[model samples]
Target: MSEPGGVSTGGAIGLVAGLLALIGGPAAFGKAGAWLADRADRRRQSRADGNREWEAKLKAWEAELDERAAASLRQCEEQCAELRAVVEKMRFAMVLILPEVERFAPSSPLLQKASSLLAEILPVAIKPAPAPPERPESISA
Candidate 1:
């Protein structure tokens, strides 16, 4: 129906209402869209934070492992040095005792002297190997 404005009033009203509905619909959707975007942003930020924390923990564990390894290596070196010193002392004692043994005979007084010397020196010349604990059942009757 024609109105004083020279356009159909009902059509004009319908067109304006349709435009407003279209624009307002998107505006309502914008809130839900923004909420979803905020949620995604929070999830991404939390993941990044968790990754950073895990990286820090891994680095700390690696550093601790390295420190323990270094300490163990140092302790091993010290024990090796002590063992080497014992081996050297045994070698020196063997060197001192051998010539005396070679110069003596099996039944002579000199041989008796050499045997006495060997008995005194042998324990000092050798480092005994560590023995395993004996089982009572394995003992000879």
Candidate 2:
């Protein structure tokens, strides 16, 4: 139908619809706001989940490093113990050899030089050797 002003009724109805959308009634604008809020919340939750996963991985890596360090420490301790035993054996040998070298000191100048070299090269802990054995000695040469 045409109105007296020469505009059709259908055109007026279209104008009213456009105005309603532009004005944005409560139902229309409210639903859009809710959707935007939901999207923001989802993004926040995703970031939080990612942060938690990263934290867990970091903790696991730290634990692995600690375990490796502990294993290395144990291996070092074992090696040190073996080295101590070898040093003790060397000291015992020096104890037995020094007396023989001293007994033959006048016969061979080479033996006297070797004895002094042994003294200089002995481990720090066994510097003086062990009093050169005792009476009867442990080994006969």
Candidate 3:
């Protein structure tokens, strides 16, 4: 049915619907945009929290590694100190015994040569060799 103004009932309904859509479209779009922004903010905060935790763990791991390295360094220094002390004691003993060793060695040119060579080389060797037996008959030529 047409109204007196020649507008049908369906046309009047369509006009009203179009006007409502125009007015409400911007409001609905703004709400949806705000919701999306809030979601993105939440995600960003979550990532930041994860990053902070990772950083803390990395720092702790670094501290543990530093402690281990410091302990190893201290142990190595102790070992070096002990080795120095032993060396010093051996050097003192060598200083006391060297002259007697030379004097008591067999009075032969070959034996003297060997003894001097041994005295020169002993300090540098890892361990001192046992002294040769002191039998005159065994060394006599």
Q: Which candidate tops TM-score?
A: 2
The digit string of per-residue lDDT tens for model 1 on 21-131 reads 677776746765688799999999999999999999999999999999999999999999999999779767655655555544334676466556656755744322344
Candidate 2, 37-136: lDDT as tens digits: 9999999999999999999999999999999999999999999999999988987787676666556454477766766676677644322232444556
Pairs with backbone N, CA or C atoms under 3 Å apart (clashes), candidate 2: none
**All candidates' TM-scores?**
0.56, 0.61, 0.58
**Alpha-carbon RMSD, each predicted model:** 18.7, 12.4, 13.6
| Residue ranges of candidate 1 with Cα displaced over 4 Å | 1-24, 105-141
Residue-wise C-alpha lDDT for candidate 3, range 40-107, written one tens digit per residue = 99999999999999999999999999999999999999999999999878766765555565555546
Reference-based lDDT, each prediction: 0.73, 0.76, 0.74
Instruction: Sort the candidates on lDDT, descending order.
Output: 2, 3, 1
Error of 3 at 54 (Å): 0.6
Error of 2 at 8 (Å): 36
